[model samples]
Every structure is written in C-alpha cells, then in structure tokens.
Target: MNVDFWNEKFTQTPGLYGEEPNRFLKIQLQSLSPGYLLLPGEGEGRNALFAASKGWKVLALDQSPIAKKHTLEKARKNGLDIEYQVCDIEKFIHEGTKFDVIALIYFHLPSSIRAQIHARFEAMIKENGLLIIEGFGKNQLKFSSGGPKNTEMLYAIKEIKSDFPGITWEYEFEGNDILNEGIGHSGEADLVRLVGRKLSDYLIKISN
Candidate 1:
C-alpha cells in the first residue's frame, strides 16, 4: 500500500473520513462490557477515538504516518487517549496480548495477505471474545459505492467460515444499502456483516 496516497487523502481538512464510530460496530458493542479493542487499518482514528469514548482501551494501527498524526490529533481534540501505531497489517505481531473485541471494518487486502491476517486475528482473541467484521461483499462492484473494483478483494461468507472456523456464528448476512464512512466509503453498497463469538475447546472437523 502507498502511504503517500493515504496521507494525501487525509491531508484535507476535518479528516479523510469523518470522526464517527462505524454504525455496525457501535451496535455490536453496545451490550458488551468495555475492554481492549483492536482496530486494524484504523485510518485517522475516528473509530478508535469513539471506542475510547465508550471506555474501550483501543489500539489503532495503520500504515501511514499522517494517519497516525491525524488519529492522535483527533483523539486529543475529543479528550480521549488512544494508542496509535504506524504499522502495516502484514508486519503486525500481537505477541501474547489478546483482545476482548477485534474489529475489522472495511480493511481489504490481497487474498494471501488476508489469509495470514485472519490466522493472526484468531490467535489474538481471548476465549469467547467477539469478532465483529464488516466489508464489501462480492456484489459491491455492481453498486456505485466506494470499494475495490476487483472481486478478489471482496468478502464471502464461505471464505470467512473456512478461514476462521474457531468462530461460532452469532449473525452473518449480506445486503445492499448505503454506507457512511466518509470519502472512501459511501453510497449504495453490498456488504457482508458478521458478529461471531470464539468457540471454547470444542472443535469440529470438516472433510473436503
């Protein structure tokens, strides 16, 4: 990913993306107790800052320095303290730390990289932890909303289930509608929404 491309994008006024938590994220986390939250591809920190406002200890990671700077500035403006890191998703290492909630919102990566990242995400979640994810589904290209033109970058239910079998589905579905994420994401879109909880020691074996 080109850091400059995103930097220049966020160089404009208020932010490239406005300061608001994702609607789906807010709803999913509403009933849960506050705890550590991981936000990958957390550009400009709008989501992270909002989560911090809700008492979540948020760790926002992005690849752009300008993104990090804007995130900190926005957090300070909101009187919130958020840990911001300038790091690419492919290079991130979680060590022994695990999160109660891991949110993946509109962060698209190549299929290979996504596979690796999904594995890491599974390892970084505490038992019974919730994983909330929203992304453009395969049908997104038919809509005018912002997203990659390539279908490979989009998500499918089967792909997610196969990749992270440890997560028991609480809710999973696809739909077409409006998405408000500022410049990069807006307008009529097709998306996949998932809210899942990590399974305990139980494991199911599938034969191909």
Candidate 2:
C-alpha cells in the first residue's frame, strides 16, 4: 500500500471516490439484512458511510491516515458512527471476530500478496456470510479509466473462484460497464463482479 500516494490523494480532493456508495454494493445491501459489514481499503469512506447509514455496523480499514481522517470527518457530518482503523490490511486482526458481510469494492492489490490477504479475509466471515467484490477485470488495460496500470493488480473471474473455493457463488460476471463513482473512477471500464456465500462449517464437515 502506498500511504503517501493515498494520503496525497485524499487530502488533495474532497472525495476521490465520491460520496455515493458503489452501485452494485448498494443494490446487494438493499436486499440483504444489515449486519456487521467489513470494508477493507475503504478509501474516502463512501461505501462504509453508506453501510453505516443503512443500520449496519461498519468496520473499515485503510493504510492511509488521511483517508481515515477524511472518512471520520464524513461520518461525523453524516451523524453516523463507524469503526475505522488506519493500518495495513495484513496487520489488521480481530481475534474471534466474524462479520456477516465483507465488501472488497475496487480494492486492487499487488499480485504478490493479494491471495494471502484474500484468504485472511475469507477466514473472518461467519457461516453463510457474504463476500461482495467489484474490481477492474484483467481486460481493464484496454480502457483508460481508473485502476492500476499493472495487470497483476487487476482481477480475473477464474482467479476469484480459485481464491475463495468452497463457497457458493450467488452472482459472478466479467464485462464492461460505465463507471461514474467519482473523479477517480469515471468512464467505461472492464469490470468483474462477484457475490459469494460461505458454506456452513457443518456443511463443509459433512461433505468432507
């Protein structure tokens, strides 16, 4: 994670990702019951703030202090209280804590450690928990929109399925879409979206 890069990003702009929540996230959350929602790399707090407003206990983590500060400021103005931590995602650990939902919207990471971080996040989900993700597809290189320039940082559907095995995929697709999240993510983009539910521990045991 580049703290300086994100620090400057959030500080330089009022809302780099905009104040509105991701469209996919908003739709999914609307139908599901509100519970503990965990958002990693929650830059600028748009999604986290939306979850908080919807009566979900939101817990967000980011590497940039400026991002956290901006998030808190937004929460305060919205009259919402959200738990936020400024730290590396790898170093964040909540012992014996589990969440009902984990959102990974646009949380692109270096390929070297993305798998490890994902596995750790998977372990934090309670039985039947939902994992929602939306990120730039491997084909995103063709577009001049937001996302990392490194192909390794982008996502592929096959890799997502392999990364979170033993879960039932409720929805999964990879295609192009017009994204207008903010000044950062605007225009047409190759996107990958997924929603998976963790199999119950008992079910896994019995199947094994």
Candidate 3:
C-alpha cells in the first residue's frame, strides 16, 4: 500500500488499528531482556509504545507521514519517547547496524521486496539475536479477518527456514482464531508465527 492509501485509512479512523501491541509479539517478547528493538511497518505505534513502557529502546519505521505523526502523539500520551521514521522500507538502508531483537509484525510486501528485506534482516542481527515475526499464512486468503489478499505476500515455515538458513528455529506454528490486538486484528484469522535466533559461533563451528 502507498502513503496516500494509509493516510486515508488513518484519517478515516484516527486509531483504526487501536493502540496495543500484537498479542503474539507481547507473548514472545516478554521473556527476552530489554534492548534495541526494531519494529518495521509499525503502524500507529502500539507495539513500539508498549515496548517503550517495558524500558526497551524502540525504533519504529513506516512509510506514512501521517502514521509517524500519530505514533509520536500516541507515544507522548503514554509518556514515552519512541524513535519513529517515515521511510519506504524498500529504500531504507540497514547497514552497520545490529539489533538484539527485530520484529516484523503484520508487514506484508511483495515477494521480491520480501526476499530483499529478509536478507537485510539476517545481516542486521547480532549473533544469537532474536527475530520475531507474525504474519498471514498462505491459507489466510480463505479467512477474512485482515492481511494481504495475495497468497505470495503471506508466509510459511519452510519459506522462513530457507530464507534464514543460519538461524536456529525456536518456534513455528500456524492457527486460525481471533486475534485481540486492539481492534484491527480481530476475528477468525489464519496466521503464522515464528521465533528464531541467529546461530552462534559454537553452533556454526560445530556445523563446519
């Protein structure tokens, strides 16, 4: 979707997506230590603000300027300061940066862009860093809660495994159910969730 599309969506309903972290994200990140957390496609700042409340330094990025404004306002209202940027993910550079934890929650782009983004993500993580992703599955087309209509935009376990070959898969699963992430992500939805870690030197050396 383009900036105008999202701007119109946010304008139609000031908080169309609501102000709360994704359920899956909250659950998976709770046990991890606080550190630099990156939230790509972080619409409306719910997840970023939530992480901020937990003392995590967050960098939220999105393409919509309107989204950037609203997210900042939301963070301010919660007495939190979250670093937000308005940039197209395709053009954003991820060089000389490493994150302890990176999150890709409900960010769907075309396969071509997705492949490139995944590669950058792999390079951006420090050894043993975590990657948490939750998105619509290929089967989501059959369900109607929310997500890209294109099957190619959705994710699968095998696809993720192939994309991040050096990462040790910690968790992977799919299910259909109501997602109570405020309001937007609700009702019966087909989703895929994964938590993985970059392989450490010990494991890499062993493999060799």
Candidate 1: 10-residue stretch with minimal lDDT: 199-208
Return the lDDT, model 1, position 156. Answer: 89
> Would you give me the overall lDDT of model 3?
0.83
Q: List the residue pairs that clash in candidate 2.
A: none
Q: What is the C-alpha RMSD of each candidate to the true structure, in Å?
A: 2.2, 1.3, 2.1
Which residues of candidate 2, in runs, are more than 4 Å off?
Answer: 205-208
Best-fitting candidate, scored by lDDT: 2
Best by TM-score: 2
Better of 1 and 2 by TM-score: 2
Clashing pairs in 3: none
List, residue by residue over 1-208, the lDDT tens digit for candidate 2: 4899889888888688888999999999999999999999898899999999999999999999898888899899989999999988778888756999999999998888888888888778899999999999999999978999999999988987788765789998899999998898899999999999998877766865
User: How much does candidate 2 score in TM-score?
Assistant: 0.96
lDDT of each: 0.83, 0.89, 0.83
Worst 10 residues of 3 by lDDT: 177-186
